[model samples]
Target: MKILHVVDMISQQRGGGSAKVPYQLGEAQARLGHKVTIYASDFHAEDQLPPKGVELKKFHCALNLLGGVRITPSMVFADFSQFDIVHLHNYRTLVNIIAANKGRPYIVQALGSCLPINGLTIPLHNFIWRNLILKRASALIAIAEMEIGQYVAEGADSKRISLIPAGIKCNEFNRRPARVKDGKKRVLFLGRFHEDKSPVLLAKAIKILNRNDVILLMAGYDDGCEKTMRRQIKELGIEDKVDYIGARYGKDKADTYAMADIYIMPSRREVFGLTLLEALACGTPVIATDRCGVASLLPPECGLVVPFDEYALAKAINEALDKDIASSYREYRIKWAKQYDWSKIAPKIIEVYRKVLGT
Candidate 1:
């Protein structure tokens, strides 16, 4: 099969998980002897090297209309008809709009953006999605069970929606990291320092916890909230308790997760907690909010699911380090992570593709 994967950008720092899903999935699919090409904007083209088998087609994005809705004017004239199947990595983007307008059947994996958020674009996005994208989509993929409802709310057909979790590269995290023993135990946060991710919430929670033994290692690319988070950190006087590392990727990301005593997903809303799985796979203690879609997939003995309250988050963090609430979870971390590896998960996606193609 000839597969075309579409995304807004092609780098981890620029596109986060959105860029990764396609590259990984396409690579895995290519290994199965299928031709895969990924279509994306040239956000950070020079830095990215897509995995061996996947072909990356990058078009120049001339304008950014805030919140990742960029205008790649050239993509308007580009062709997508040659592929046997098309996969869209995000919702409400020029790429998706073009795929819909092209009158070709495409599968949509919203990558957790199905919820009607992202201000100003909501109404317009709704109108376009409901009227066009949703109607034209052959299938809708849910990374978690909760995302199925999000697809329904977005006007996607229920029968067309399939639950498909994102795949992980297990081998990259196979090396166990030796933690540098300081006096303090560290809890790591790996994501963009954006308001949506609730960087300030974690800072406030760290302040509320007021612990001498635990340190919050905040690492990520800043998405405009670092200044505010830094201000609040200073105001709360928890500067010494928190360390701001820019971002971690490749082996560094694996090492960061492995070295941590605990990992946290403090996002106000996370449809699929990729970092949560990474941390769990690394055998790190973990905490997530109730709103995390991936939380449902984890067993009770694996992680703490608290509400979004700073106090509650702080309490969970305390329990994760002190009580060791996840003993059984640690025992099965590596084995469990292998279940969602691309090698296993990609075959299920191929089944979906086969069904869609009626072959």
Candidate 2:
């Protein structure tokens, strides 16, 4: 099968998990003896490259309308009819609209963007995309079962939706040494320092806990919220207790996870929590909000889930710090993470592809 994945950008710094899913899936499909190509805009060329066995084709972009939407005029000149299947990642982009108009049997990966939220242009955007574009796709892939209703409500046929969780490179993370809490326990929060990720809530949680022995390490690229977070940190007087380490990847990211005692994800909403899975694979206990899609897949022995409240998060952090479950649960966490390995997940995606192609 010849498969082409269409996304906004291919760089890890800009695309985050959207870029990763296609790279991993393409690699997995290539390993299965299928031809896979990833078509994306070359917005950030300095970031990490895709894995082996997956072909990457990048084009130049003309403009970026919204912060999230990419406008690549070059896509209009490209020929997409040769591929057996085209997979579109993320919606509300000119790239996706172009791909959808190519008259090929395509699939749309929602990436948690299907849900209706209070926004000025989002409702109108979704209505047009859902009715005119997405509803006609071969299939709509939902990363979590919780997202199926959102698609259905937006006029997608229920039978046309396939629930496939995003996968990770488990071996890279599982090979790391188990997290050790030798001196002051380190609590790590990794992801964009944006309002949606609830970074301010994390700072408030640290302030509420008021612990002298624990350190909070916040690592990620700033998505226009660093100033507000810093202001909150200073206002709460937890400046000394928190450390800001800008965006980590590769070995640095693995090392950061290995050094942490607990990984905290206080997101108000998440379609899928890739970092949480990475923490589990590294045998680092986690404290995540229940709103995260991956929280449902987490084993009880691996992590704790609480509501997105400062006090609730602080209490969960206190309990995780005081409990000595790391050594006992290390193997369990590693074992649970293996279920999400790309080697296992790829087959499920392949099955969906086969269904779409009727092969």
Candidate 1 per-residue lDDT over residues 1-359, each given as its tens digit: 99999888888666788888998899999999999998888877655777788888888989877666788888888888898888888787778888777766689999888876677877877678777887578988889988899888877789999898998888887656466778677888899888889988888888888889978899998788888888989999999998988799888888998888778888888888888878877777678888888887777666788898999999888877787543345657777777888999999988888889898
- What TM-score goes with each of the models? 0.95, 0.95
lDDT minimum window of 10 residues, candidate 1: 324-333
> Which clashing pairs does model 1 show?
none
Compared with the true structure, the alpha-carbon lDDT of candidate 2 equals 0.85
Query: How displaced is residue 293 in candidate 2, in Å?
Result: 0.7
lDDT of each: 0.83, 0.85
Alpha-carbon RMSD to native, per candidate = 1.9, 1.8
How much lDDT does candidate 1 score? 0.83
Per-residue lDDT over 149-211 for candidate 2, one digit per residue giving the tens place of the 0 to 100 score: 788877889999988899988887864554554668788999898888999999999999998
